[model samples]
Structures are given as C-alpha cells and as structure tokens.
Target: MKITPELVEHVALLSRLELTEEQKAQFSRELSKIFEYVEQLGEVDVSGVEPTAHPLPQKNKFRPDEVVPGLANETALANAPETEDVYFKVPQVL
Candidate 1:
C-alpha cells in the first residue's frame, strides 16, 4: 500500500495531530517504506516453521520470589522537602 498525503492527513485528523506540509510528506514516505517492508516480509516462506507464542522456553525463566523486609518509614521519609505525619505534603489541588 502506497502512503499518500490524503491518507496521512486523514490519520493526523483522527489522531488529533497538527502536521506541517513537509511533515505530512515525510510521514507519507516513511509510512510507504514500512508498508513496503511488510510486503517484502509477506513474500517469505514459513511453511515448515512451527508457530510459537514466545521464542524462549517458558519454564524456570525467572528467579523464585523471596520475602524481603521493606525500608522503615523514618528512612523512607528522610529526604522529603515537605512531609506531614509520615506522608509527602504537596500543594492542594482544586
């Protein structure tokens, strides 16, 4: 699929983006190249390849989770510019 200015403009409108004329042209070219690459990928033969949800084996991929003591409240609040009652104090929001 060839990317055109009208297509780019339509996408921009849908995405609520304001693109300059040059940017629109650039995006059109870039999008066209991506589509061409996808077309090339479509030409490859993968008839004998097995379908997989992931490339690596799923079992034993991560280390076992261990319970660790968290930092004390006083240590966690040591570097606060503004704190009140063990909590960070920020400006009031309306």
Candidate 2:
C-alpha cells in the first residue's frame, strides 16, 4: 500500500515530529516501500508451522543450594566508617 502525504502528516503528529516538506516526502516513500514488503510477506503460506520460543535449545546450569555460615557481624562491619552497638549508623534524613 502507498503511504499518502496525509498519512505522513498524521504519523508526524502522532510521533510529535516536526518534519519539513522534504522529510515528509522521504518518510512517505520509505513507509510505502516497507508496506509493500509487508504485503509481499502476507502472500506467504505457512499453515502448520509450530510456534517456537527459541531458535536454539538450551539447558539451565545451576549449582546445588547449600546452607553455609556467612561472615560474622564483626568481619562484615569492619569496613564501616560508623557503627552503633551491633549495626551500621548513618546520618538521619528527613
């Protein structure tokens, strides 16, 4: 299908684009060519093709989950510039 100047104007309005007359003409030609290509694709017949999620098959590789002791509070808090009793302290924000 051919894209008319009116259609280009509408598209420009929808996209909030400020197109010069030259740009509008250029876009109209490009959009028409794209529409023609799509029209050609519409003529292809693919009746029973199965929809695929991915072109290539893949398997998830994961490590086994295990409970382990983490760093103690003293070690974890060693890098903090400020800490209260057992927790890091930060300036109060309102």
Candidate 3:
C-alpha cells in the first residue's frame, strides 16, 4: 500500500500526535519503506517449514515435588519479637 500525506495525517490524528510538515513527510517515507520490505517478505515461500514458539528446542525445567517435614509452629514462633496466640503480630498498615 502507498503511504500518502492523508494517511499520515489520519494516523497522527488517531495516535494523538501533532507532527510538523517535515516530520510528517519523514515518517511517511520511513513507514513506506517498512511496508515495502514487509510486502517483499510476503512473497517468500515457506510451505514445508514448521511453525515454532522458539528457534531452539524447549522443555519445562521444573523440579520433582517431594513430601518433606516442616518446622514446628513453636520452633518457628520462638525467634519472633512479637506474637499473638500462635501467630506473629505486626503494626497495622493503612
């Protein structure tokens, strides 16, 4: 598609941008080049290529879950500066 001054002005209005005449012209040229390159890319053949999320092989690197003994509540509460019943107490936050 051809990039025109009208298209640039429309885009500027949509994007809430206030481009000068020079800026509009510069952006029009740059955007036209980008669109041309994308159009060229669309002409390439890739019928046999497989679509992939990553270039390299990827696998979930999760560790195995195992049941383990946990610290007793009394032992955990022993080091606390403040405690209310079996739980630690802290200053109230707004």
Candidate 4:
C-alpha cells in the first residue's frame, strides 16, 4: 500500500504522536520502503513449505518437582528487626 501523508497523519494520531512536517515526510518514506519489501516477499514461492511456530525445534527442559521441608515460623522470623506474635511487623502501606 502507498504510504500517503494522510495515512501517516492518521497513524500518528492513533499512536498519540505529534510529528513535524519533516518527521512525517521521513516516516512516510521509510514506511513506504518497508511495505515495498513486504510486497516483494509476496512474489516468492513457498508451496511445499510447512508453517511453523519456531524456525528450530524446541522442547521444555524441566527438572522433576520434588517436595521440600519449609522453615518454621520462629526460624523465619529469627532475624527480623521487628516481630509480632509469630509474624514480622511492617508499616501499613495504605
């Protein structure tokens, strides 16, 4: 598609951008080139190729989930500068 000044202005407004005349001209030129490249790509043949999510094969490598013992409340609060009955005392946020 041709990248016209009107199109550029619409895009800028949608993106919440304020572009100068020079910047709009520059962006229009750059965007035109990108669209031309995409148009050129449309001419390439890929009849036999299968669409893929990734270019290379990938698999999740995860370790087995294991149960572990957790620290007791007293042990966890041992190093706190301020503590309540069994919990750390922190300032109210709101």
> What RMSD does each model have against the real structure?
6.7, 11.4, 12.5, 10.2
Better structure of 1 and 3 per lDDT: 1
The local lDDT score (0 to 100) that residue 20 gets in candidate 4 is 98
Question: What does the lDDT read for residue 69 in candidate 1?
Answer: 94
| Candidate 3 global CA lDDT score | 0.90
| Candidate 1 residue-wise lDDT, 14-71, digit = tens | 9999999999999999999998888876778999989899988888568669988998
lDDT of 3 by residue, 1-94 (tens): 6788789999999999999999999989999988887898688898998888898998889887987889899999999999999999999967
lDDT-wise, the better of 2 and 4 is: 4
Off by over 4 Å in 3: 44-94
| Model 4 per-residue lDDT tens digits across residues 1-94 | 7798889999999999999999999999999988887898788899998989898999999997998889989999999999999989999969
Candidate 1 deviant stretches above 4 angstroms? 44-94
Q: Residue 59 of candidate 3: its Cα lDDT?
A: 86
**Pairs that collide, model 3:** none
| Model 2: CA > 4 A from native | 45-94
Which residue pairs in candidate 1 have backbone atoms (N, alpha carbon, C) closer than 3 angstroms, thus clashing?
Answer: none
Q: What TM-score does candidate 2 get on C-alpha atoms?
A: 0.45
> How much lDDT does each candidate structure score?
0.92, 0.91, 0.90, 0.92
- The Cα error of candidate 2 at residue 75, in Å, is 32
